[model samples]
Target chain A: MNKMQQRLLHPSKATRQDRFGKTISLICIGFIMILTVSIIGFIAIHGLATFFENHVSVMQFIFSSNWNPGQLGKNGQPQVGAFAMIVASFAVTLLAAILATPFAIAVALYMTELAPKRGAKMLQPVIELLVGIPSVVYGFIGLVVIVPAIRSVFGGTGFGILAGSIVLFVMILPTITSLTIDSLQQVPDHYRKASLALGATKWQTIYKVILRAALPGILTAIVFGMARAFGEALAVQMVIGNAALTPTSLTSPTATLTSQLTSQMGDTIMGTLPNNALWSLALVLLIMSVIFNLLIKVVGKRGEMKK
Target chain B: MTTNETVITTKDVRLYYGEHEALHGINLDFQKSQITALIGPSGCGKSTYLRCLNRMNDLIHDVTITGSFKIDGHDIYRPQQDVVSLRKKVGMVFQQPNPFPFSVYDNVAYGLRVQGIKDKKIISQKVEESLKQAAVWDEVKDDLTKNALSFSGGQQQRICIARLLAVKPDVILLDEPTSALDPISSAKIEEMLLQIKDQYTIIIVTHSMQQASRISDKTAFMLNGDLVEYGDTKKIFLNPEQEATSDYLNGKFG
Candidate 1:
């Protein structure tokens, strides 16, 4: 056969629709890559400008606690260190993780392993509705119910770090639980049967076999939930009192980087040191989110390697 | 012909899934301390019957069983018979190797620990003994800390068998234990079964007729939940009284 004949014979192998579909998908992927790179580049450049152009020392910015964007520091420099806000962000997110993990795991286990199929199917959508609630709605609840309750019980000033952490805890609970259930469900049935057939009870099979297999996925869920809690601003801000000072106790008011940015960004003029410092805060948050997400991929790879 | 002791006895066994009946009136006696191979085509209820022996079918929902199943004259279908203790006496291995996501030592030790054995030294000894009996101790002795899944497919399957052996059950039911393995691995398993048949009553559900002839002392042929023939391995393969059994062995059709 001639080359032309051979080529004509296999037209359906890579048809016009196939090529078109491939081209369109490649273009979509390229668009997303370009968007991500440009946005990250913009944040990096604008965020670093606060330190480079305004003559703020990197070490001073990292270690110093003062964050008064309106006031000048010693030698007539704008006070731009965000040490207190960073600590508050981490502390509140850690507290939320500690509060949410046990409940999420319990719910996930009940849904995936213990509950009847009909019950699990019914409970899944209802529990997932918690994630659909708006952050503003959660903020309102924290403002109206949780903050006051904390004040009455713990003798606090009502608006405090504890309030913020509690609100974040509620916000991340559904995210972790739903993802954990999915991960647990991904474990093959044969492992459970193998354990059970060996005379191990159902609870034993869950902890020793099913849970061990689903651990990487559970860790990924937690990392994603923690990232969401760390990035949450609106709800945490409403209950965290928006204070800029360092918190001495759980009852003491505090400020996160997001809360500070939201409060000061509207009034601060562009190209000023205050606006630049706000950009720096966004930069830090962006980096942390990316790192947390990357950690999931690393964990998945290690899990596969072990297997 | 019936001089050997019976380890498992089932009469008028009927299994149902919700409303549909899958197995209908299976009656047979499995021989004690010997390999009994149940051979037939797919969807023939061989595996379902195997699972029924140890109540593994209870894991599925809406499964109702009515029959008299007994091991050493103890009625297994009775409500008072605890499923956990029943399973302890009759262990099982699956078609696929399903070791827990733990080290090799832990996989072998899982059964004893389930029985609440707390002594680490005793667990270590039994783990070694079970691995040796399964003929995998030499290959894994230096690497007991390695994950069981990190081993080859055949090694993983042997480890699963070793896990079952560690429990020291009176009976072991295998659901096509070598179907997922290569030819060499399948032969290894067949040879291992030959060596261990004197101590454990093993009931295996197999698709390959040759494997049944190679390892089993007694053969039970099933066709869509009906036992067509049950006799010595040599008699069933060479002079089956039923036409369907001979047809299946000759490969006329599954």
Candidate 2:
């Protein structure tokens, strides 16, 4: 073969660089996969230890509200029930999502349809700034302002599911709003024009056509916001009162899985039941996050299929 | 069929998009129950002018319009003229077959439902009649609940026409409704327009000269934001008054 033909057919400097680039990317991905798998595996092993090694039945761990892991209950079973925390987590996440969704949709509509220039130039940056603010700052604000506000209104220590939901509402508002704006923008402009051309009023077109077309995407956005609210640690912990009790009312003290885990993780001995219980909580959080991710994927796939 | 009865009259209509004038003082009168074709090259403001008739251009920001637009001798641009009702009297179909990502039944009944007609029986009856009027009933009769976007482009376009017909507007403005379709679909739409011409005043913006001559009762040729020629389709095609009209018709230049 000629020199040029041989260079084209065989490994050259460019080919070496290509292989090197591929190897580097592959190594990076491999490292990430290993890190992720090991993290999940570590959490899983320790989390299952509560039921396996400690002999805590899954039903007692999940359904029993008596969560005193350091001692045995009257029934001779370990009191490691996560029912309250699970309920509180769901309550806070759902309340926050419900409180935030309408506001997010309104802001997104204002940005995408009503006043795009003002939204892009003014509101977009403000929302991005809200997202950039550290979660600790949000926690601090919740602790000082929201707690006292609730105390004055509801006659409590001001630390409860209400305060936590309010804090999470603020925290996840920007996330939901930005994602909602993206979904609203994804709706084809032709839909708007078609609706308007049919003699539909602007409000009718927005509600009937634009919002309907963006339903799945908006649902995905709300789910993502719920995920953020569910997994949040520091902010929710500060406002949620850190009480290991069942929430009876909106203004009552409660403990979410994340808040409980964060509060108890540092205090427990390394190999104790308390520590294993915290790991179990972490496992719940991990599973919930996976479920959230799957929900987003399913929603996105359903939206595409409808299209 | 030249008629003395004018349905829509626009005298000296000018439109500007952020200081860039798109339509320059266009004056035209559309007759009642007649198909008028506006033929032009791209960016000649044909679609822009059509949008003005129904005040659809009001949706765009930084758009300044100056002129008098009257429908049935009532000034439609008046401050008290209620754009919503004006649009009900004047409907538009776009170049793309834009059906709401909904069922065919919902898509056709959308206009009626917008007017707050909540009776299901009336809505279904109107939807069926509109679909049949638009010549798409036979194809979509079995799949009324199927999503309109799931259909082929041609069927989707027909569904859009049905949507427009469901509103029962006196004037129908189509902005190159067949430009995005194949020849057979275009022919179908042309035939459907001809069938409905006696019921509504139809104004179409088209690039195909053959389409204009084949379907339009009167053809108006526009160039560079100016109405260059306006007359009978046969006269404009066979014996032209302006040099530019013949030139464009012969494919000499756009």
The prediction achieving the highest lDDT against the true structure is: 2
Q: Estimate, for each residue in B1-254, the C-alpha lDDT of model 2 and write its tens digit.
A: 34548889998989999989988898899998789999988999999999999999998889999989989999998889888999999999999999999999999999999999999999999999999999999999999999999998999999999999999999999999998999999999999999989889999999999999999988999999999989888999999999999999999987
C-alpha DockQ of every model = 0.75, 0.86
Candidate 2 stretches with Cα past 4 Å from truth are B1-4
Q: Per-residue lDDT tens digits of candidate 1, residues A128-219? A: 78888999999999999998998998886788789998999999999999898988988888888988899999999988888888889888
Per-candidate TM-score, first chain only?
0.93, 0.97
lDDT of 2 by residue, A257-280 (tens): 999998988889987998998899
**Candidate 1 at residue B203, lDDT?**
93
Per prediction, the TM-score for chain B is 0.98, 0.98
Q: After superposition, which runs of candidate 1 have C-alpha atoms over 4 Å from their true positions?
A: A1-20, A74-77, B1-4
